[model samples]
Target: MANIKLKGSGYGQFGGFTPYGNVTVLAFALATTALGAAAESNSTAAVKNGDVIELGILPTGMRLEDAQVIITTAMTAATTGKLGFVYEDGVDDAAVPQDAAYFINGGSLATAARLRASGTKLVVLPKPAKLVLTVGGADNAKASDIKVLVYGELTGPK
Candidate 1:
């Protein structure tokens, strides 16, 4: 396990060298990856903008994030709306917020928000705690198997 502590949230001219000083602060961070191998099936999801799809966790302690699905075979246009992931068992599949969602625009890295005619390179965003990643795809295309690469990190505010 890798460990690191930032001096502070922001740079200060006369900040204390250690946490014993005033406004002491501490933070915890971790990175991990998970997988979900299955064909896109009766998966229920909707794509929109600024949506938060919280993937689950890791054994050591971390969160899940979105990722690009690097497939050797070209993704068919008909496959539009088929969500892919690099992480698995790492999705927020529940009420209040479902496991998967769609963004009107593509992700910061790739347009995972929509279909990439030929393919796509999904962007990985930081995930919160207590959620696993579960890749969603076209509700119609659930029968077709889509390989997703899920990767992300978990950070705690102290």
Candidate 2:
């Protein structure tokens, strides 16, 4: 049998390394939980501190489609940072942004745009703030609402 050293300078012995029936259970630990799905009040999920969180529909029902989308929230506007994505003809082909898209990506608070084609994937990576899937798309020629699934560990104070 083996033994372990205890703290408090008091020598306490624990069961040595073993197989079944050798080391018995002494104690257990608790677990932690996470937040629920919901947009925060007073703009909990809104853009804060000059953050550029990718826009996604809240409440999980919006469908992806081709149209003019106005991000009324003050966080989406930017004269220049990144267009991130572009789509047309049911595809995000190789071409420059045109009339309906080029301007939507650059603006101010409550003014941002996005585009999507049927059966294509859209991805957005933000510099600040967190993203989640708010809505999803249905059939063709419809608007889709999706949550922004953030990738990687964000290190900072909340």
**Candidate 1, 19-120: lDDT as tens digits:** 443221112221112222122323243322222333323222222334444333322233333232222435652422322322222322222232222223
Lowest-lDDT window of 10 residues in candidate 2?
A: 24-33
Stretches off by above 4 angstroms in model 1 are 1-61, 75-77, 82-96, 102-146, 154-158
My TM-score estimates for the predictions, one after another, are 0.28, 0.20
Q: Write down the lDDT of every candidate, Cα atoms only.
A: 0.30, 0.24
lDDT by residue (1-158, candidate 2, tens digit) is 77976668332223443333221211111111122112333233322332333342211111122223333222322322212232323233232221222213332222234322222332221212212111221111211122122122112211
Model 2, 99: alpha-carbon shift in Å? 17
